[model samples]
Target chain A: MSAEETVSQPNPIEQFELHRIFPLEINGIETSFTNASLFMLLAALGVVALMVLATSRQAIVPGRIQSLAEMLYEFVANMVRQTAGKEGMKFFPFVFSLFSFILIANLIGLVPYTYSVTSQIVVTFAFAALVLTLVVVYGVYRNGLGFLKLFVPHGVPLPVLVVLVPIEIISFLSRPISLSVRLFANILAGHITLAVFGGFVVLLLASNGWSFLAPVPLLAIVALYALELLVACLQAFVFSVLTCVYLNDAIHPGH
Target chain B: MKMTIISPAFAAESEQETHETVGATGGEAHHEGGFPPFQQENFAPQIVWLIGIFGILYLLMSRVALPRVGGILENRETKIASDLEASREMQAKAQAAARANEENIRLRREEAQAIGRDAQQKIANEAAAQRTRAETEAAEKIRAAEARISAAKTQALGNVEQIAIDAAASIIEKLSGAGVDKDRLVAEYRNVKSS
Candidate 1:
């Protein structure tokens, strides 16, 4: 439960709480715009604005913004090219957008007092589901029933095949769950750990006897913050690299 | 004795439990018992915004940004290619011009050398002609000078011969009382001059 603070202790989960900026509904659907949604929008805008401003001048000699944008473009482009093959370049836009959105969303969440969109299960799951959907759609579209051949491991004996096939199917089914969880859990855990450590400082300082120990928790929070920053970027990269791998599966779908 | 001590501790524990439960219940009632993201109410807007913004980002990337970057990169490639080609052409032109310049200098040098040789030959010919004309004129002057001196000596000798003949005739008339012919004496002086 988020925002579950009690009288006795500071609940770290409260940081994940959502409050609607404007309570909204339509056709009997409650569509309240949330802090989570706000940050998601900010992250998207930040990515778009970066790309637009970088290429706005289109100078032969790139400036800092252009260099960053170009580097990011080539980074994702090369990732798809290497993992998914040249044909995979068709999905470069999708991969770039996903990578940018997740990376920026993760970074922004690291800022104090800002919401972390990728930390939300719904957001990460939505992204995972999108990747899974594309993989299934393209895999089947390109390879037809041959795509199912991916499950049947080659050179395995008939008796051993029974065990391997189900494992492969289960593993395939688990991709989205793992994809979403990896990002969601990493961010959720990092932020919560940071909050838990930070709460100890308040708890220590508030207690007359433990005032001297407040600095200890405060120092721990500092160390955790740096670690959290690394986790933020690492989780984003992990998510992107997995996306490319899944995409490669879609493209090949044979082995 | 155990009951007396345990009762207070039990009462204190129950009271704390009551307070904690009340707070938990109160908080649960307020936000409800779930993760905010899992709450059914928030999903629609999040999904909606996610779709909308992701759509915009995708369009911006595929339609505008990526193509623009590609165009710029391709433009740079062509620019480099054309620049290299132009430089190569210029180099070729420079090489050709240098060759032509060297050829022209060679031609001019050959022409100047030919003119120098011709002028040397012409001066030699003119000097030889002037030397031959001067030599012929000097020999003619020598021959005329020699003829003139010989004629003058002959005339002086004739005058002296007449004077001798006259002197001899006067002596012969005065001393020998005989005068030989002047013509004969002149003839005898001419023979003696010949011998």
Candidate 2:
């Protein structure tokens, strides 16, 4: 038991561990650069390179890269058009960046030992907060206090509104939390599961005779990794879609 | 219970020994139960970099990537629409030209027909005038010939009358062997002529 206790653990959760790369301080602020920063920078750079290089030629006939870039452009463009009307296209840059950043971050995380920026709750919250902030600013600026009409459900009894109105407000207020948590949780869980299964392979291989059983977890890891990739892409899409839906409320407040 | 059954018995001890020796360097540092993300030390850097990277990304997306892409698409769309409009205009122009050509041909044909009819009418009038002139000449010639014939007949008839009188007188004189009375012969001739 003592010998067993001395043995080091497989530690799947440690993959999420943040490490300081360049310790930094600005005006008595602790702003040390870290692994999360590195991956985020990579993700952003990757996105920029893709967008810039893809559209550099601006060919009348699109190549693969240009097609991809244009596809992303139209995807968000259509989303905004559908959800928030043409007026909402003004916010397309922010929404597109949000989607691209999250997607790239998630995909980068799927690499063997990279940090997932979107997996960070604070990071996801930051995106969600920006979306909410834009919604509030646009809603109030455009509609004034009439923006409060979002909470009032139509075709319902006035008496029921007494009870239902608060619920509506609560749900409205919960948007950022739900949106942020959904993305964060998906990435967090997927990554953790992947790490654990990866750890399982290591554990099985380390033990005598248990090495034969390692292929099962390895296969599972392969499948889960595939699933994580899907989840990563889907989560990014969901985040952007939700952003559009929320912006829709800002644009047309009554409904 | 599962560990003891390994067939690679010789390698297991060496593996464990190395693992034990290097375990501190690789494993113990990461496995602490406290959540790695919530560690207060990591937040500030992540935020600062997040802001920096995300700002750059936003700039790239908004100012560079999006506008270029949008311009390309917009340019293509406008080009296509203008090309379509131009082609449509050209088709309409072609049709109009064809219609004008048809009209020109019809007008020319009608003018030609009118010219032909005018020429035919003018020829007919000239022919009628010519025919009338020819007929008048023929009629004048026939009148002159008829007058000449009537004169000739008058002269010849006078000569015949004189010859007849002379023959008759000579016959009477020769038969009777006397001179005939001129007044009596004239009176007989006049009676015969009158009869």
Candidate closest to the true structure, highest TM-score = 2
Weakest ten-residue segment in model 2 chain A by summed lDDT: A1-10
Best by lDDT: 2
Which residue pairs does candidate 2 place in steric collision? none
Taken in order, the candidates have interface RMSDs of 9.1, 6.8
Runs of candidate 2 with Cα error greater than 4 angstroms are: A1-15, A23-30, A53-67, A110-114, A137-144, A188-231, B1-31, B34-44, B67-131, B166-195
Candidate 2 local lDDT, B61-93, one digit each (tens): 999999999999999999999999999999999
Measure candidate 2: CA RMSD.
8.4
Over the stretch A1-255, how does candidate 2's per-residue lDDT look in tens digits? Answer: 001112235544556677778887999777877888889988998898779987899998899989898998898899888887888899999889998888888998888767788877778888889889989999999999989999997688999999999999999899999898888778876776665556667778889988999899889988988898899899999999999999989988898
Q: Against the correct fold, how does model 2 do in TM-score?
A: 0.71
The models' CA-based lDDT, in order, is 0.78, 0.80
Off by over 4 Å in 1: A1-9, A154-160, A209-216, B1-32, B37-41, B95-195
What TM-score fits each model? 0.70, 0.71
What is the model-wide C-alpha lDDT for candidate 2? 0.80
